[model samples]
Target: MDVGQQPAAWHELAATFATIAAALFGLFFVAMALHLDAISTNVTVRARARVSLQSLALSVVQSLLILVPRQPPLWLGIELITTEIVYVMLGAGLRVRAGITALIAAMPIAAGISLIAGHGPGLLLQVPAIIIGVVLGCWQAWNTILPAELQTRRTVTKARR
Candidate 1:
């Protein structure tokens, strides 16, 4: 199959992805900052926040790699896999959080392997992967911003009234 032939379309997609990923990171950062105390003191919240940022940062890196001019499919694939490796490694001590990250990284990892093999959905797979990453990141960010205890407090307060 022909690779790198559809540069124009892929570049546009990648550029858009990079833009969205960066913006999401910014929002997540603010959320993390707002709950800094909660996150620092709570291991779970801290892990979630770390995963959120890790996911967003990986998405940005993936998008940038995808945007590289005339890059070979195998090279892109290797890069994606390598990035995921680092992501997994970074989440190593997080236990279940790392599992969650591995699941989320699965799509892009598969897409990368597929690209390397010159078959399958190729770059298109990353579209959903990117969307998924964004959602997961945002979810974790929200959790950081409002941990369960805070949410429970709000609920109890409301119930009292």
Candidate 2:
């Protein structure tokens, strides 16, 4: 594919990514709703849940941005970088796994920098970023919720003793 020409492949990729991101966001929302009380009552859990939601929202927005016709590569790069920075900042207060969060945060910024520099096919870089973001989002949500659930069960067992 020529550097200057838009790849025909992007359309299908963008559509697929957008759909998946949207679905993941919906699933996360439902999960949050189910655990609303636990999340709201605990400050730590609330922060983690907020970060998780932000991560998913970032992925969904990035996927939709890819679908925009005639979007400037520079603008997309800026958007990606900005969102990553926001994610990192949001996670700053949470007791998340630092290594995983760092890796997840790095992927999108690296991809965005490549896109800004015009290193190679934009989609090639962008697609991985989206995938990583979605995976990270889901992981954060599960990481936040599972331990709380376990703790609740343990407390109930102790009370029964």
In candidate 1, what are the lDDT values of residues 1-161, reduced to their tens digit? Answer: 54332334589888988899899999878766765666788887887778788878888998899898878888888888888778778863263455565676787788788888878777777677777777777777777777845955776799999
What is the per-residue lDDT of model 2 for residues 1-161, given as tens digits with 9 covering 90 to 100?
33422424476776787787788778878877877777788887877777777767877877776667777777777777887797678654245677766776776677677667766555566677677767777877887788677767787899999
Q: With candidate 1 superimposed using the best TM-score fit, by how many Å does residue 147's alpha carbon deviate from the native? A: 2.6
In Å, residue 148's CA in model 1 sits off its true spot by 9.1
Question: TM-score for all predictions?
Answer: 0.78, 0.74
Each model's lDDT comes to: 0.76, 0.71
Clash pairs detected, candidate 1: none
Q: What is the lDDT of residue 147 in candidate 1?
A: 83
